[model samples]
Target chain A: MSGGVLYRPGDSPVHRIPPQVKLLAAFAAVLGVVATPREAFWAFGIDLFVVLAVWSVAGVPVGWFARRAVIEAPFVLLAVVLPFVSGGPRVDVLGVAVSQDGLLAGWNILAKGTLGVLIALTLAATTQPRDLVLGLQRLRAPAWFVTIATLMLRYVDVIAGELRRTRIARISRGDDPRFLWQAGAVARGAGTLFLRSYERGERVHRAMLARGWAGHMPAGPAAPVGALRWVAGGSPALVIATAWAVAAWPV
Target chain B: MTASVAMHLSDGVLDASTSVLFGAVAVAWLAVAAARGRIDVDDRTAPLAGLLAAFLFAMQLLNFPVLPGVSGHLYGGALAAILLGPWVGALCLSVVVVIQALLFADGGLTALGANMTNMALLGTAVGFAVALAARGLARRSRAGLLAVAFLAGLVSTVAASAGFVVEYAIGGQADVSLGGLAGVVIGVHAVIGIGEGVITALAVGAIVRVRPDLIYLVRTSETRELVAA
Candidate 1:
């Protein structure tokens, strides 16, 4: 079962910045990186450095962050093989036919994706989950979208825990999930889970009405965000500027 | 099918009108989910929605290699439908896609509607239907039920991918052969479908044992059966 690593309270400058600033800056940085032309290799490298600097200010443990960031490994793996796939005039690399265009495309993806993931990781590691949702809501993200996200985050663990218990029950009953031929049991398990989750949503909705819920969800007190507060709190704009300059530099 | 299948299509591939059309559909679906019955927002539902969105987001980030060259990511509609009802599942997955598009740029903003249709509406609707049919035939047999779930998940993914190919044919930016490219994309997805099916089934099976009432699709079955009896 996949679990979320929520933000723990800390005195770090990164933790003190309002969620909105982090959200905007991180998104802006990602956009900047992705929009960078194919020739901007240096710019991508500098973006990486800026992201790392954010993690440092956030007081995130490098080891723990690295482990958590491993979630991006699959995407990274895909990027690794990209240069070899799209067919073109092949360049000899260790006696292998690798497409030069594919390599460039792969590099582009790897840089942007890696930068995006890191920015996200830094944001998640430093900010509380609720704050992130709240920030999104404040930014005019749709109410329905925000509300649904809030609920999903809350109940995922409860449902996941239940799933684990059920799996154990099935295993104890001599169900060998490992056997591909015995896939029927696995299918049933999924169907059964669906039924349970559906019913739970109904039940949860009833409970809300019983407690006097209105059509729209109410937001918390708006937090005042000052420019200086954000600049010091988040990674500086100069870092991004430097990265942009590098990305624009000659190949 | 290559393992690194990009769920997000290029902007030029889908015409502007098509994107807006799908976007409207996605919005309408969410509106229906919001307007249905009790407008009361439950504490549990909201939190669960967020977490599930996160789970889906994270899982999609971890696109596993299904075979030698192809990779697949968690599309999440079928899985969400199993855990949350089709209406809510559709809403959740679409939101996830929107978030990815806006925040990550993994999916283009212009084609957001099409992505939602492929990953959320079509994926969840078809997956739920297959699961329902499977459940109907295998109501009495545990093994039969599992088979149905497996097939449902597998078929749903292929159907979703096929929908992409169709959309591409309609709004193709390149000179690639429509029928041939569509076939290739769908064929590879068929194999990737197994992994999606297994992961979805495994997740579903785990949840059902603890709180059968928590599952959206299965809950319908038990209730309907009771009503019939």
Candidate 2:
């Protein structure tokens, strides 16, 4: 639950936008970013600007976002290795000849990847988990998929809590997870936790049936987004997408 | 032992066509899985599968230290497939991947297809098949089951790395040679696979000791016996 990076309650304009529109807008922005040519460096810059604007408006601290975005560290390592290993026309930089095309490729990964992650972060920071499930349903995503997502969200916190408790119990019983021999204990704990969760799922399912739950999950009471809200929600993505399309066009 | 968790392919790493192609294939697989109704609300399987997804999500967050400053998390595709069968396992992993991308920003949205293909499709499918084959050859003894689980994890990680090489060959943004790239990727992943194998084997072994009937692989064996009868 501590890792609930998906949503933070807020009253910003971005937060007020309907979840479906936000979802669509986020998807559109990502498509625009991915579709843009890597050579269009200016396009990426503008994309970054748009993302930053959203961040500022949302009032999320730069540090908060930056810390979570550090998940990209591994990819950054791979990107750094690209220039030396990848072959192409070489250029001298800092007394070393590196592949020009590979340098561009690495920049492409870093720039576009950062923007994509930021946009996704914006979406997550605004929308609640429950709203996201409802948004998917409203967007005509498969009913079963939505149902499973809803159920999974409900129990993810519970299972995570159970994991923490089990870890504490193990530690209290002289089990050290850091030791190699304790690997078996840790894994066995995971298995035991999973089995308990599975049994709980069975009981939960039976309870749902007892409470008259049918195959279809009942829709939430949130109203669908109106056309005005759609335009408002989609405007940022539209602006970014147009910039991408223009930059991607042949000269 | 440095156990590197499976890395998410970032955006711009693959050409648009390659990403789209993989994305389409992944969606089709999901459709097939859905149509098969393997994860449908059957009063038992659906809730169990949903909980499995949540449990995997939580477990993935736990990074155990393997060496000095190097830690590894459970990939869990093999473990999921062994417990829930392939279709349900793939679906569960897919759910976890989607949530990670949408909620946590852990993986790129455009690269979701590649991630799912590597972790969900190839990892689970290859791991499950290899485990089943090994079980058949080893007479399904408890020790054999654990060994097979280990092999499944080891092989699946390498197989997913191979899949990455193929994808890179098709639409690699870098000008790196396929042979060199594949060598590096596979070699590194093979070592990481040892950790994957150990975790998967011990986890599966633990369940076998307590509730063998709950395991999908064990259930399949019982069904085979019933059909023979």
Candidate 3:
């Protein structure tokens, strides 16, 4: 659980910027990048430069971001298969004929994914998980969604820790779970966790009722984004706008 | 599942009908939840809900490769519903989808409904029912609960795929056979479901062990307090 990076405290410029701006910028950048066509090599390059710059400004350690970013690389697996799977003209490369469309699809994924991950990483790196949710609500995200997400985040660590212990307990008992036939122990562990989660939810609900929690969750006034922060944050939107316009025009 | 995936807004494809339909559905769900008083408005719950949605959104952005050509993201709709109850869980999941769409453009605005219905509603509702059944059958035994979770998660993933099949039949973009697509979709997803079930059970189990009180899905001792009173 500790291996996964949560919020680490830092005084970088990103830390000082309002979470709302970061939140907004993250969305804008993602949209801009996604809207980019596969052919816009220079557009993707510019996006990469901007994301790296933001990462630096946030003062998030390069190693930490790099490690955390690894979580997203799995989606690249889709790109890998695209060439073989997609129907189109084939090009011979390295003794293998790959679909030209597939290569384009891969580029599309890489570009969109890299930019998407960068935006997400920036948000995750700069803001605490809790603050990020608040920003979503402030940005007009629905209340029910916010609640489930909040609880999930709060409990993810706890649940993950429980899983670790359970695995350890099983191993200590000389259980080797590698064989598919030996999965019962792991399965039983899963059952145990579900009951605990169910019981826990009930308890939490009662506590909520006691505190006058109705169904709909209320909002909080965590500070607002500053003007200068908006300026800095809004800069990406301008860049994206420029790119979008260029992409939109007939070449 | 592909259709359902299409239903949920993704980056490459954008269509007005899908966007409008999805957006409307999202709004409608919120309205319904609000009317049903599912969204708990309080100092503690609201902020936490929003936060959870945000976290889910972020976590989903981090997809892990599950196969040579496939990757998996956090599909926590069922887990969330089991913990928070369907009302809250659905809201939270939809929130995550909406955020992903608007911010990340991960899902399309038009296909939001299809996404919500498949991932949030069908997945969560089906998962909750199965989990509840598991709870009842196990008499609150932890082992029983996990088994239920495994079954529920496994079933729900397929169900989500099924939801897509039905949608595709209705709004078919291609002339492919529904039977063929359904078979392929369900087959692949069933395999994926094992991973989903295991990961979900493990995550939920770990939470139940330490901070069982924090898990919204579990019934608390305080409910007994009310029953005693």
Q: Write the residue-wise lDDT of candidate 1 on A1-251 in tens digits.
A: 12644455687888877878877776556555555665666777677677777777777777765665454454465456655655566788888888776566666556555565566667766777667778888887667677776676566566666666767898899975443435455445544545555556556666776877554458879868777877665455457755666666676
TM-score against truth, every candidate: 0.69, 0.94, 0.68
Ranking by TM-score: 2, 1, 3
* Model 3 docking grade: incorrect
TM-score of 3: 0.68
lDDT score, residue A170, model 1? Answer: 81
List TM-scores of chain B, every candidate.
0.83, 0.91, 0.82
Candidate 1 stretches greater than 4 Å from native: A6-9, A95-97, A181-183, A230-242, A245-251, B1-76, B79-87, B95-118, B125-152, B159-185, B194-229
Q: lDDT for each of the candidates?
A: 0.63, 0.80, 0.62
Task: Estimate, for each residue in A62-178, the C-alpha lDDT of model 2 and write its tens digit.
Answer: 787888787777778777888998887999989999999889888888887888888888899988877777788888866567766777888888988898898899889897766
- Report the error of model 2 at residue B6, Å: 5.7
lDDT of 1 by residue, B112-206 (tens): 67778888888888988888776765355556655666677788888888878877666533334566666777887787778777767666666
Instruction: Give the C-alpha lDDT of model 1.
Output: 0.63
Candidate 3 lDDT, B101-140, residue by residue in tens: 4333344333457777888777887888787776775347
Give candidates' CA RMSD values in order.
6.8, 2.6, 7.0
